[model samples]
Target: MKAIVLEKAGGPENLHVAEVTKPCIKENEVLVAVKAISLNPADVKPKYEDEMLSMMYGKERPVILGWDIAGTVTEVGSAVTNFEVGDKVFGMVNFPGIGNAYAEFVAAPEAHLAVMPSNVSFTEAAATTLAALTALQILSGKINKGDKVLIQAGSGGVGHFAIQIAKNFGAYVITTASAKNKDFVLSIGADEAIDYHTQKFEEILSDIDFVLDTQGGKVLENSAKVLKNGGAIITTVAPDLPEGVKAAAEKENKTITNILVHSSAEDMNTLKRMLESGAIKPNIYKTFAFEAMADAHREVEKGRTVGKVIVTI
Candidate 1:
């Protein structure tokens, strides 16, 4: 099997295309012939020194990095009841662990795999795994009809999905993005798009029922100020709240949650329904060939991609 392997967590140069041994499936796993793989912010952890990576690389063996994949099941273990040979499947495979999705084949647990939407292409399905799952999990049951929700980094992968998901449940969604992407965000379902470059979001939006904070740091700190009493906040990064936000939330009685998305077939079925009904759509910002996996990682590292970036195998 061919794979992009990383020997160390340092630079894109460390990632290279190589022929590696094919992975074998466990009793509870399925062997997927990965057709397309998508990149995320987590894939860039190697660029920073001493940063705690959500995914680990093997020091002795070549580490394959990636979690989102849309592929076909070539073989299934005896315990795999939900999927079988020739099944088109997609999911975030083994997230928070060794997903090893950046390859021609991957051994995915049955629980982490979902049947691909029949109407969606492999590339589109691949684009929706981890990022879409994050958005779906964070906003699921966290907001309701007529509620006002605020999402940060609305033009990025998770942000884009969050905006569409919030709107699906009839929530009025406000989001922050660059001036260049303001119209793009609105077209995708955001009711209001605040240009983070020139305007202050906290000053303009108030009494938000939910705040989906994709950008951490001061963004997380200032999110509390815009929420109404008892409003809730969910951040994708930095589980801990800054002292200022904590004080504001403590005084105002607002709730907070930090999102670390988990894999679920039920949630994937929800996405399947959305896709089939044309409720939520994927915005693939870019696509790279299998040999260009390093280039894809470089693009994601810039942190400016408007949506998902995928590599076709």
Candidate 2:
């Protein structure tokens, strides 16, 4: 089997395609012949940091990085009954840990896998897993029609999905992006697009019901100012609340919380319904061959990609 392998955390130069052993599955897992994988900013950062890799991937040599995958189930475990050998499935496998998806095959737990919507292609389904799930989980149980929601970096993978998901819940989506992607973000359902380079979002926007922060640091901190009293923020980029955000939120009677996305079959199936109904659409900015994993990483690292970047096997 061929897989993209890495040793030590570093740059794109550390990623290499090599022949490796195929993975075996436990009774609760299914073996998928991977057809597509999505590249994300998260995928790049952890691989370049030793501490993160050790904590996330468990100090494994020849670490395989990636979580989003769409493929067909070629083999099913003895305990699995919801799927068979020929099922087409996609999901974010074992998030907050190694998924080992950047390869020709993935051993995913049966519960983590969802049946792929017939109307969706493998590439599109592959791109939908991690980013879409992050967006979905972040917004769940917190939105109502006509609520004001701000999603930062609206052109990036999670941001794009967040915009569409926010819109589906009837929220008024406000987003931040560069001048070049302002229209693109709006076209994807953001009711308002703030030019981050030319405008300060915190200064102009206020009374938000919910904030989804993808860019950490200043962006996450500033978002605190706009929330209405009793509102809440969900941030994925930052490990903890920005230095003073918690205090400010407390003062204003608002809430700020950090999130790490987890894989859920239920969420993926909900997205599948959205995909089939045209309620939400995935924006795949680019797709690369499996051999070009390094190139895909480089593009995602640029922070300018307008949607999901896919690597196809």
User: lDDT tens digits, residues 1-313, model 1?
Assistant: 8999876557787789899999998999999999999898887765444234322554445678889999999999988899979999999988777888989999999998789989999999999889999999999989999999999999999999999999999999999999999999999999999998899998998999999998777888788889999999999887477677687798898987787888777888889889889888999999999998878888998889999999998
- Cα-based lDDT at residue 241, candidate 1: 73
> Which parts of model 1 have CA positions greater than 4 angstroms off?
47-55
lDDT of each: 0.88, 0.90
Window of ten residues with lowest summed lDDT in model 1: 46-55
lDDT of 2 by residue, 1-313 (tens): 9999998889999999989899999998999999999888879988878998898888769799999999999999999988899899999999977899999999999888899999989999998988999999999888999999999989988999999999999999999999999889989899999999999999999999999998778788888889999888888866366557687789889988788889888898899899999888888899999988999999988878888899999
Q: Which has the greatest lDDT?
A: 2
Model 2 has how many clashing residue pairs?
0
User: Clash pairs of candidate 2?
Assistant: none
Worst 10 residues of 2 by lDDT: 237-246
TM-score per candidate, chains pooled: 0.96, 0.97
- What is candidate 2's TM-score against the reference? 0.97
